[model samples]
Target: MREFLQRTLVWLIVILFIGLAFWAFSGPIEGLIAAGVALLAWLGFHLYHIALLLRWLEQPTAERVPDGFGAWHTVFMTLYRTMRSQMQSKRKLTNVLERFINAGEAMPDGVVVLDENDRIEWINPMAMEHLNLDRKHDVGNQILNLIRQPSFHAYMKNASFSQPLVLQLTQPRELVISVQLVPFDSTRKLLLSRDITSLERVQTVHRDFVANVSHELRTPLTVVGGFLETLSDMEEVDQATLSHFLPMMMEQSRRMQSLVEDLLTLSRLENSPKAVMAEKVNMQDMLDTLMVEAEGLSQGRHHVRLEKGCNQWLWGSAQELHSAFGNLVSNAVRYTPEGGDIVLSWKAEGERLCFSVKDSGIGIPREHIPRLTERFYRVDRGRSRGNGGTGLGLAIVKHVVARHNARLDIRSEPDKGSTFSVIFQRERSAEPEAQPENQA
Candidate 1:
């Protein structure tokens, strides 16, 4: 509006000056003619500016705005400023959108965006892997056609997304995904997916653990109950019957007790914090004690020997190490046949120290080696039970080894022998104790 007034005032001034000049130099008729000519010239000037404005509007960029004279200069400058501000706002919005997309790409969970028609608008990298989607090909396609799960299709069609959908995918590897739909922008939706495979596995392991514990206890309880019932029924029992039933009941009771102790040990190891390594374990004494225990457990069946190749003590809990080492030694004695060799050795290899039990026992098969550390896992269940094994020995050993930052290696051959070694790193081995001074 201001530019319009300025243009009108300029035209009136030009006409008035031209008319006054003609009136002073000539007459009234000549002055009127001069005013008409001035009006035409003023129209021509405005037309030329209009042409420049129209040409610049073809591109409509701030940099391309044409220079103008008189009122048109102010109009061009205002137009340039408005265009520049809009461009800056557009660049800012573009940057924010890019950041949002980058965040989705970096997230561990999957994210998918769907338009009003349930067509794929954008999908993150994880979502592509979870749903088997191609960014180039799958975009703009209906998500239902790609997912193809009946439950998922029904979920979208119903639009009742109160609960997340648990989907088990077989292709692109077996995966368990928790999928949820969140509506946004009144029409569009965000599809979120999280991998819950590990959680599901843990829950399955918990259920199996409970079932196994129940099954293990029931047998011993049933045996004890049966014997008690028999004793009660027999008012005058014979000495032979008493001798047969009493020992059997005692053996089952002892077995149950062992199982309970092992379970408690495992629970403590799992729940307790790391073992304190301030106490230095005397490896020589510990190895000697293990040898004696192995011999006792052998009962003059297999020959047991201890090889003390290194005098270095260990920096760890003495009680836990004793338990771990004893378990391995006893297992060797129990499994080895009569006249077999059982050697318990403590030696240093380079910067590491190793405690190994090598026995000529019924060695494990190759396939069972990987799962030997799992609780209640036995290569030969019947043989293991006959030998009075609790099946939690290796699992306990594994935990103890881990607590001390050590590694347990097992090597075996069928019917030949098996060697179980616990290797401790340099950090775990302490220097040999100093000898007494000459003064004594």
Candidate 2:
């Protein structure tokens, strides 16, 4: 108020000065005219400066204020400085906002921002993948309306969000999602989602593994325990009966031993970070050893043949490759009928070298083919037991192939025999001439 009064007083004094000066030269009427003209000129000067300021405000830039207005020039400069400061602050805030959005986009989990009314305000890229949301179209739509899951709706509606909600979505595919909400900025909410399908699968596998191990051990233990009780109860058991019972007990013990050994092999393969070291493995030598082992396992029950024409050497762990190759050959021999033919072949197909075990035995059903590599999975449990199989053969083979960066391909149809092939990467295979004779 004081500044306003001071400005008004100054303007009035300037007009009075003009009036007095005109009065000294002329009469009072002329002086009044001169004062009015002077006042009009000053008003026009201020109006011109104000117009420039308004124009600059509409589209501001780093340009100097227009001059020639005297006192008004100072005011214009002050306004320019204030505007420049505001622009700098706005640029800084925009940079920070962009960084925040980029960090959210890089995250694996999904993030979403919602208004007080549960309407989506913004979402990251991962949120689009997890929730199948269109960022542009989904904005302003209620989150509950889009998700529409009962568990999620109930959790969102509840007053407290103490725990996260797990939901299974079956749209794009089967997916398990864990969703949680956080209250922020007073009424606004931040929602987070994570895909837990793999974790859930691991948990289920662990449970089944424990139960299977217990069941496999329990059956043999019961058999051995019952036989021991019978022997202890009899005072004078006949020699023939004792011999028969002892052989059966030994067979049961051997079965248990094989199961334990397979379990150990699987555990070792699962825990190892990588192959110990990659060396040139002679495929011919490896196949020779497999043929001998297959013959022993077959016991003349099946005809086994080997057709070798691969590069002769592959770069990988010798033990691991041997184990993997031996498993496939032995499985073929075990499954083949007494008169059926089992063919083991190593040949180059395209860029890959394939080690295949083809058998003319009972083929696998289409439904069970996918899970043939699973531990303790058998098409016929009684048949596998009678053939002295521990059911962990294919599982071990799978791990070995993975360690060597190879692929396991199975083609089978029920009653038409089955073919199992391990296709090694071409990069890992070497020609006989490329490797030294000693190394080969």
Give the winner by lDDT: 1
Q: Residue by residue across 1-440, what tens digits does model 1's lDDT show?
A: 58868788977997999998998899988998998888888889889989999998788998998898778888888888999999999999999989998899999999999999989999999999988899999999999999989988888877489899999999798999999999999999999999999999888878877877787788889999999999999889999999999999999999999999999999999999888879988787787788789888998998888888889999999988998999999889888889999999999999999999999998989999999998888898878878888888999999999999999999999999899999999999998686568722
Model-by-model lDDT, in order?
Answer: 0.90, 0.87
Clash count for candidate 1 is 0
Off by over 4 Å in 2: 1-11, 24-27, 54-68, 276-278, 430-440
TM-score of each: 0.89, 0.90
Superposed Cα deviation of residue 427, candidate 1 (Å): 1.0
Summarize candidate 2's per-residue lDDT along 1-440 as a digit string, tens digits.
Answer: 35445665798799989998998899899899999998988788778878887877677774655553466656766666777888799899999998998998899999999999999999998888888899989999999999988888899989898788898998677888898999999999999999999999999888988888888888888999999999999898999988989988998899899999899889999998877435878787788899999999988888889998755588888888888888898888888888999999999988889999999999999999999999888899989878888889999999999988899999998877999999988787866545576865
Which ranges of candidate 1 are over 4 A from the true structure? 9-33, 149-151, 237-240, 435-440
The candidate 2 region of ten consecutive residues with least summed lDDT is 62-71
Which pairs of residues have clashing backbones in candidate 2?
none
- Compared with the true structure, model 2 gives a TM-score of 0.90
Q: Give the lowest summed-lDDT range of ten residues in model 1.
A: 431-440
